[model samples]
Target: MRVVRGREFVADRAWGAEDIASMNGVSTRLHWTDQPYKWHVNDGEEVFVVLDGKVEMFFRENGEEASVTLGVGDIFYASVGTEHVAHPVGEARILVVEKEGSV
Candidate 1:
């Protein structure tokens, strides 16, 4: 089992970006503040596990905008090639996991 503390993970951006290799997959935690970040579309699918605070995930499809609110323990999946933006409603910490060689 892999265990990580949100407070410790948030302390260093480099540490948060460190690659975790396991039989299941590679995982990384991304920490965000209240500032909004740009949307992104990657080649790999991703599962975002909300560890603290709240976040808004916005996506656009067929010229329509869709969004959802996620809080602690909430998991959000970003499909491969799906364009989306994520912003914290407050201070937030999220663990992002993706398959190796997928990103």
Candidate 2:
């Protein structure tokens, strides 16, 4: 069991993360970042959830780039082979669920 005051959480630096859980090959983590993540495709599916603050999610589909703004409570699903990146709108807290070792 774990308890976190998510809204009050802050990262040590850009892209800092707190491990939440890992079971049956799936892992869950809470991340804090003020900078942007590098664009990359996951080896498997991924679930991106915003717990606090705001974020801009950028993705490439069919060689065309697109983006979306995500606020608290928003969820982004990344399927296999989907290339995407995340840019925090200041400082943001995010929850990520993905296969172990998938970045």
* Clashing pairs counted in every model: 0, 0
Looking at candidate 1, the ten consecutive residues that score lowest on lDDT are 11-20
Instruction: State every prediction's TM-score relative to the real structure.
Output: 0.74, 0.96
lDDT by residue for model 1 over 1-103, one digit each (tens)?
6665664455343213435444565645455455556777766888887788788989887778899999899998987777888888867777777766544
What value of lDDT does candidate 1 attain over all alpha carbons? 0.70
Model 2, stretches more than 4 Å misplaced?
A: none
lDDT scores of the candidates, listed in order: 0.70, 0.93
Q: Which stretches of candidate 1 lie over 4 Å from their true place?
A: 12-25, 30-32, 99-103
lDDT for each residue of candidate 2 in 1-103, tens digit (9 for 90 to 100)? 7798877777788888888899999999899899999999998999999999999999999999999999999999999999999999999999999999987
> Candidate 2: how many backbone clashes?
0
- Cα-based RMSD of the predictions, in order? 3.1, 0.8
lDDT of 1 at 59: 85
In the predicted model 2, the residue pairs found to clash are: none
Candidate 2 differs from the real structure by a C-alpha RMSD in angstroms, to one decimal, of 0.8
